[model samples]
Structure formats: structure tokens, C-alpha cells
Target: MPNLLIIEDEAAIRRVLSKILKEEDESYQVDEAADGVEGVKKIKANDYDLVLCDIKMPKMDGVEVLQEIQKLKPEIPVIMISGHGDIETAVDTMKKGAFDYIAKPPDLNRLLNTVRIALDRKELITENKRLKRKVSKNYQMIGESEAMTKVKDMIEKVAPTEARVLITGENGTGKELVAHWLHQKSERAKKPIIEVNCAAIPSELIESELFGHVKGAFTSANKDRAGKFEAANGGTIFLDEIGDMSLSAQAKVLRALQENKIQRVGSDKDIKVDVRVLAATNKNLKQEIADKNFREDLYHRLAVILIEVPALNDRREDIPLLITHFAEKIAKEQGTQVCTFTNKAIKLLQNYNWTGNIRELRNVVERLLILGGKEIDDKTVTQFSGK
Candidate 1:
């Protein structure tokens, strides 16, 4: 149910607004405040989806109340009710933070529409906050080793710039995480960050995937579509496993980098794009260039700032921290308490070779959470960890 607050100095107007809101929807819980003081108190005490405040109250006017609400709870949408004489003041209040302004004799349709819009805006704000929390949790970088620390420092320094970043690391070393952090921390954070896995897509279709194709360009191309670069306009595009990209696609990508433009498959016209490019590959680009498997020009274009993620075996000291982090995260996902790992268990796990790196470690942690005892000892680690 949506909670609403009506802060009107006129008793008749207060009753009318409450009656109209309650009659409009049985789910709306409307509360009335005689003046601004009482309204501020109620607003501070409760969470309201919308607030209707009179612009010309005796104790404290709507503008003062809106200012207070801005300080107390800026998320709550406040609508200022104003008379003919207070119309200018009501508009000023909106500039000061009021969500909207309603006339002295509120129109039935206008009042209802305003209320609905305010409630919808409030819901959207709440949902966006929730999603931001989830995204932050998902992209959390967990490691305090020297190598990890250097990567973090580089991200801080380089993330603010428009320079292309090429992350180099072995498979499963969390290259994708670095790309996400860079986008999340950049000036283009508000825009989309489109990710394309070059290795996952077939060589034949890679060009069409990166640059959209017109209808009949390919058998699968039925209609015109926007490709990843167009979708990431005014944002960032992360090309993962760029070493595996075909030589033909590499030539097109190099052109896009040099000209800040791309031509769709089967189209001669070029579409200009403003996208910050970030690439990552597990393969050694120099070796790939030597073998003529990858383009040297493209590699140089993408590697303006190189970030090499350390293999898990090299950062064994961070295993304990990673274990605790993964344990808490897995517990939350599983709706269970976080299991503890004994010191001996930690030591044993750290000594083992992490062939698959952090990706493998997270899976092992989840497995232990399911199969190991409440306190995972060295014996439980040996039995379940496949060591």
C-alpha cells in the first residue's frame, strides 16, 4: 500500500483531499497534518510515498517544509498545494525541491494524475537504489595481495580517463570484473557498458554481431538491428577474449578504433559512435601477432593502459579472505548461515595449485559450504576439495 501525507492548514481542504485519495484507491493510506510543524513531525516519523503540503501555512510555509523534507528525506515526493495568490510561491517551492504544485481548487483528473505519477516516481527511485546495491555486490573485487593492490591502484587512476584499457590475464582470472569496475567508475558510468565475448561467437557471425547487419545481409539477418557498438554509444564496450577475434573482424575493429565509426555488415554508409573501448584476452597478444592470428595495430590501439590480473596461485595469501568473502556471499544466496573454515583448512587450501584461479576457488567454496561440516576442518577440506 502507498502511504500519503496531506499537510493542509484548511480543515475542509484536508478532509476533501483525504476523502478523494481514499475513494480513488482502497489501498492508499492517507494521513492529515493540520500545519507544517505537524507535517514535518509525521514526515520524519514515517515513510511516505507522496506529500501534499499547502504553500501558505501559518506556522511554516510549504517552501520551508519542502526544504526541511529535502534535508530529512529527499526521496519523498512533495506536492505543494497553492491558492491563486500563492501560485508564484508554489512554483518557487518546486524549484527548491517540491515534486509538483496543485492549484487551490484541485481538479479531479489533475490531482489523481499527479498522485499516480508521484507514486510511480517514488517506486522507480526505490527500485533503482535496490538494483545499484545488487550490482555493487555482484562486482565486488576481493583481494588485498600486492598484485591485487596494484590492479586496484591502476583502476583508480585509469578509470577516470577515456584511455583504452587492455586487461591481460590467464583464463578464469576475473578479467571481466576489471572491465566492469572500469566502466562503473568512469565518467560514462550512466551509459550502457555492452560486453561481447569474441571467443563465444562464431567467426562467421562475429562481424554481424559487432556491427549490425541490414535485412538479407545474412541468412539469419531477417530485419535491421543495432549492434553492440551502436547500443554502447556514449558509453563503453568491453570486448572479452579479443585474441580469439578473427583477422577480418580485427580489421573492422581497428577501423572503428581509428575513426570512431563503424559500418554495418552489407552497408557502405558509416555510423559514427562515441564508445570507450576496453578489451581483455587470456592469450599473449605479441605471440598471437607473431603467428599472424591477431592484428598488431588493434592490439596497440586497445593497450593504451594494460592491466594484468594476477593468477590465483601467485596470490595465495588472499585465499583466506576470498574464502570468507565467498562463504558469506554463498550463504546469503543459499539462505543459510556462513560456514567457518579452520586455520588448518585454510592453510591446506592455499598450498594447493589454483589452476583455474579465482573462478575455481569460488566454486570450491560453494561446494564446501554444501558438503563440509559447519566448521570446515582440514579433514573436511581434504575429503571435499579433491586435493
Candidate 2:
């Protein structure tokens, strides 16, 4: 249902407007105000979707009322009702943030159409804000351990600069979380952050995947396609699991880094791109270079700033916080009651060998929440957490 308010000093006009709107749509909950003072008071005490104010009024004129609404609750769309002589003033009100204006003898179709459009726009704005909050919550960091503090401090220092970062950590150690934080805090945060799992793509197509390909470049190349570099142009490209990238593809990435340009797989044409590079890996790049499996030049280019994410076992102090975070997340996802863990249960979990790191811990937390009691305790941990 949409809530609407009409602020008109004339009792007869207010009654007729309210009657027409209600008959047009019974879902409209319309409220009336004798003057701008009463209207502003109603506004401050309620959450209205739309407001219709008359240009000519006493005590508080429509212009002053509109200004107050702008300062108080600007999101509510205000449509000015204008008399024949108030046409110019109505247009002036729009310049001061009025959504639109209607003439004194309002056209039935125009009044309803404008109201519907304004309500739709307000709904879209509310939905967009909701989605943004959800996205931010998904990427939230939930740790205050000394090791995590150092990593966060490094991010705060390096995020504002145009430096390439190489993040190294064991498997399942939340390396991707660090990558997301870096991108979100950078100057290019508004642009997309493209992630490529080098190990997941076949070695035969790695170059084309990173640099794109022209039509007829390969047997499966039916059409031209843009790759990660082109897609992330003016943004950040996160090469996850960089250790598994082929030696040949590494050469092209090296060129892109050095010259800020890339060539399509089967085309000699070079495309310039302004991209910040961030790479992550579980393997030792130094050892890969020594074994001739990785290029030393690319290592130097990407490691201008190095961030090493600590394994869960190394930061045991943060495990309790992580469990609570994961528990609330899982509960919300499953649409169930949020679960809590006893101190003994949290301590038991913290003492385990988290060889698979944070990823494995999240899985265990979800499993326990499903099978254990609402209040998770040491017995539940021992029985359902599988140590």
C-alpha cells in the first residue's frame, strides 16, 4: 500500500482530492493537513511515500514547507499543486527539488500517472540501497587478531596507491577476502574487480582467456571475445592461484604489466588498458622461479607490495569471533534461529588442527548448526563437529 498526504488550506479542495485518489485506488492511504505547519508536523511523525502540497497557503507557504521537507526527509516525492496564477511559482518549486507540479483543476489521468511514477522511483531507490547493504555484508571482515591487524594496516596504506599486490597464503586461508578488501578500498573501487582462477582454466586456453581472442583464432573460436584484461580495463584484475598459470601465458601477462597493453591471441593488434593487478597463490613463487616454472620478471612486477594472509591455526585467537560470524550467516541463509556456542565449544574448535583453514571451518559450523542444539556446546562440538 502507498501512503500519501495532501497539504491544502482549503477544506473543500482537500476533501475532493482525497475522495478522487481513494476512489482511483482503494490501496492509497491518504492523510489531510489544513496547512503547512500541520503537514510538516505529520511528516516528522510519519513515513509517507508521497506528498501533494498547494502553492498558495497561509501560516507556512508551500515554498517554505518544501524547503523543510528537503532538509528533513528529502526522499519523499513532493508534487506541488498550482493555481492558474501560480504556474511560474510551481516551476520554481521544481528547481528547489519538487518532484513535479499539478494545476489547480488537476487532470485525473495526470495526477494518478505522476503519483504512480513517483512511487515506482522511490521503490527502486529503496531496493538498490538494500542490495548494496547485502553486498557489503557478504564481504565483511570479522577478525581483530594481531596477525589480522597487521594485514589490515598494510591494506590501509597500500589501497590508495597504484601498486600491484601479490597475496600469498595456504589453501582456504581467506586470501580472496583480502583481495576483495583491497579492491573495495582502492580508487578504482567503483569499477569491476575481475577474478580469474588460473588453475581452473586449461593451459591450452590460458592466454586467450587473459588477453581475449579474435574470431577464428582457434577451433572453438566462433566469434571474437574480450578477456579478463579487457573486461577489467580501468579496474582491478585478480589472478587467483597464479602459481598454476602456464609459462607462455605468464609471458603475455608480463608484457601487459610492463607496457600496459595486450594483444589478442591470434591478432597482432595491441589494446591499451589501465588496470591494477592483484595476484594470489598457495605455492611459493620464489621456488617456482627457481625451478623455471614461473617468470622472475612477472614476480617482481606483481610483488611491489606483498600481503601474506595467516592460516587459521596461526590466528587461533580469532576463531571464536569467526564461529559467531559464520553461525549468524548460516542461520540467516537457512532462515533459522541464530545459534550461539558455549565457551567450551568455541575453545574446542580453536584447538583443532585447521589444516584446511577458514573455508573448512565454515563448513563445520554449518554442519553443527544443522545437527546440534540451538545452543551449541562442547558435547555438540565433539559429536557433530568431527573434531
lDDT of 1 by residue, 1-387 (tens): 999999999999999999999998899999999999999999989988899999888998888899999999999999999999998888888788888999979998789878876875576556545645655779889999999999999999999999999999999899999998998999988776778999999999999889887667888775465677877778889999999999999999999999999998988989999999999999989999999998888889999999999999999999999999999999999999989999999999999999999989999999999998789999998999975
- lDDT by residue (262-299, candidate 2, tens digit) is 99889999999999999999999999999999999999
Cα error, residue 159 of model 2, in Å, equals 0.5
Error of 2 at 20 (Å): 53
How good is model 1 by TM-score? 0.67
Which ranges in model 2 have alpha carbons more than 4 Å from their true place?
1-137
Candidate lDDT scores, in order, read 0.90, 0.91
- The CA lDDT at 329 in model 2 is 87
- TM-score for all predictions? 0.67, 0.66
Off by over 4 Å in 1: 1-134
List RMSD in Å for every model shown: 9.7, 12.0
